[model samples]
Target: MTKKIRLADVAAVAGVSTATVSRVLNAKSTVATGTKQLVLQALDELGYERPDALRDRSDDRVGIVAPDLNTPSAPEYIQELVDQLSLRDYAPILLTHSSAGGTEKYLQMLVKQNVSGVIFLSGVANESDYDVRRYLDEDERQIPYVTINGRNPNIGVPDFSSDDVGAVKDSVRHLYHSGHRSIGLITGPERFRPAQDMAMGYRQAMMEMCPDTDQTVLHSHYSVESGGRATDTMLDLGVTGIICGSDLLVLGAIRQIRQRGLRVPEDVSVVGYDDSPLMAFTDPPLTSNRQPVRQISSAAVNTLVDLMKGGNPPRVPFTFRSELITRESSGAAPNQSQF
Candidate 1:
């Protein structure tokens, strides 16, 4: 008969507390490295097969949660992540929730399914939201999880997000280098970390490069319609260049600029983020910031694997770099009289 391996038995053999053993078994992040190793070794010595859930590669199902799939960037990143996981012999199951359902409900649902792990992308809960902590401390406390484009201090889950600050700074600096003095920003809702970081980067860049230009930041949903309205507002305010948060927004802004009989780069210059699919083929190729989707997705998968192995992943936030891809939509700021 196989010997019964209780939590206390593992703790005694490992010379640690029962709680520490439980933490290791549950894949919690607080377990120290030394204690985790001892507990794992104890489990090995006890002649008990590891729990199926804790065993690596025994299961191939991983849950991927995203806020919405309508946008280009989220879907692109999800596909990349899925591909990477498949290469590692794990099958990815996707779950999408709207901004309205709340992250807590979706998270609880995933937990109930006993998924091997979870990866969240652009969900409603952000680094600043307290709801993340509530879910982190709830009924199920021991599942390995990773978040993309979101972070929280109290929650120990690993995060993989783009270097949004650097991206925005580069966008601003690019416009400045092209001689745009009065620049504007069309951004997503302020609550989201990506939007907030981009806005902060714009502000920091503005303060450093063109302190005299009036700061005109317009917050809107990450949609083309909002971009149109934002473009109109910025034009009315005499902005010579606009840095939009997404390529979709750039499309809308460009339409609005043309509707008003103004030519891109000739009337007002534009820079966009997330050089999504097909952006290079647009009427005039989009000049945008390219999110490091491949890097972020790989890091997220690797972190989840580490957690599953009872390893403490990096505590520091992981931010992947972005690059500015210049195209025809942007140019030197047109003469102020052009508007």
Candidate 2:
């Protein structure tokens, strides 16, 4: 017969009262750090089964916060992260901040629930628009956090991102190889680091490809509408090839090009970043740079787990590689005399 270990036995070994042990097992905030550790150690040593409440702490419940689940890219990556977490035996709870109030409200809800850890995906909290410190309370701010695709030098949290600069370089290089001399770029808002890095890459590539042609780079909000407007302006400048920051933007540009009675690849070639869902099903399959979503998400989750286990993760940012996927949207540039 197996021996039964009682609460009093655990309390005696931990040098605390049974009531104190109960509080610790229940995850009451009043328990001191040292006392909680002692009780946990005692339970382990005595082969006593830990209470359900204590076992269900944040080490088991991981939180995922996203800006908008409606977006194609955000949801795809979130699903990948959740699948990885399930393989690790962790329960992932997803929260959205698409309401009127914003991410601050969702963050408060997570803190109140005492989640194990949090992963922020393309949300305003990861952006520079708002001071993240202002929204977090003193205690809540101390929780383990990880950001994807963004970073803050001031905060000590781990960040996983893609090589935005390298992606842009690859896009420009492809256009150059296709005999595109006069290239145009459509990018996101100036505040985003990825946008800034891509813009720099485009400028550098343009200078290297054609030293005399005027560099035509347009900046706009990361949306389909902005892409259409930017394409109209680039066409006015007589560009032979265009590089867009997103698939949605590329779609808009394609629409604008058709409206102007121009053909894709034959008249003007285009490249896009972020190989979003159903890109291949477009009228002309998109050629894009694919961000390594699986690699980045795994790195972020593993780093957060290390932090929770009292381990110090590297303070520097971890960047994953991106690959260029060529498709029908891009082709050899036509001769200037062909027009």
Candidate 3:
């Protein structure tokens, strides 16, 4: 049998007076956002079903945590995710992980907001050092949540992610078909699961494409500047084709290549992941892998809604394959004399 919860129990857990807990649950305007969040988290943690007043108010709001937008594709995914969330009669409240606090902080804070659910669009859940206890708490408290582009198995929540390994292999194979023997792969720090998968795919693809030629995988933070810095190292290694983990990184790679007096496709070919917006408008259109944003976002929303309805879904990740888009940025490799 479930234990009955009282206002005093909630107040004690939240470190506030019973009147304060009542005020928070009654939707008083005087309560601060952080204070209200604390009360809400406490109520949920105690396994107390919120009073009708609080449940109705919180049901109108849903929390969404956006990932680092340097990837370009993230912004697009966010817009779509927000749109989908709105259809469920929930106003999406956006949150982002900052250098000062980290993803865990924002997630803990979300509990206080009394959000109907929380959607994380690629954050620390992708990292190996993620605090499983934090996520487990959400689940233990019966909070509905979903993670996109990453997941921890112990979190026991549905994860929506793209096919990182297959995407890299396709990019490498495409470059190989363009007659480029000296190819390079650049991704985020090896600690990220996506980066590790990409590195593995690159090695496997390169081995099959050019067994005698040795290729190097450059690791860096997922940003334009980091991609540019990695480009110089790949250039020195005589890479005629480059594969980047993110579309923004590809732009950075092009800038660095031009700085060294090299032309894209003419001197070197490039392929990028996460086919960003208006990439074709650049001086040289970019070749990229198209992530299924609509499919993934729709599925994520559907899964989240199911969880909210108390329906149990499989905890396994739902993987979406990326399609390669070829364009002016990639072409036949330059002659050996050019290298």
lDDT of each: 0.81, 0.80, 0.82
Please give, for residues 1-339, the per-residue lDDT of candidate 3 as tens digits. 646769898999999999998888766758888998899999899998876446643776777777655558778988998899878777887876653167567766766676767777864555522453464343334567788887556566789989999999999999888899999999988877788888998999989889999979999988889989999999988999999998878989999999999999899999998888888787798999999999999999889888877688887888999999999999998878354
| lDDT (Cα, 0-100) at 182 in candidate 3 | 90
RMSD list, candidates in order: 5.7, 6.6, 8.3
TM-score of each model, in listed order: 0.81, 0.81, 0.81
Q: Report the C-alpha lDDT of model 2 over 1-339, residue by residue, as the tens digit.
A: 445658799999999999998888666768888998999999989987766445445667788877666454787789889988888888888887655256667666766676767787763455632444543324422457788877656665678888888898888889999999889899888777678878998888878878787888888977788899999998988887999988878989999989888999899999998888789889899999988898988888898888767688886777788899999999999887233
Backbone clashes for every candidate come to: 0, 1, 1
Instruction: Give the Å shift of residue 170 in candidate 2.
Output: 0.5
Candidate 2 Cα deviation (angstroms), residue 184 = 1.5
> lDDT tens string, model 1, 1-339?
656669888888989989887888776768787777788788888877765444543357788877677676988998999999999888887877764265667666666566667787874456424554555435344566788887655565678888889998999999899988888999889877788888999999999998887898999998889999999999998888899998878999999999988988887889999999788988778899999899889988998878766698786678889999999989987766565
Whole-model lDDT, model 2: 0.80
User: Local error of candidate 2 at 148, Å?
Assistant: 1.0
Q: What's the lDDT for residue 163 in model 3?
A: 90
In candidate 2, stretches whose alpha carbon ends up further than 4 angstroms from where it belongs are 1-34, 37-56, 128-131, 134-137, 337-339
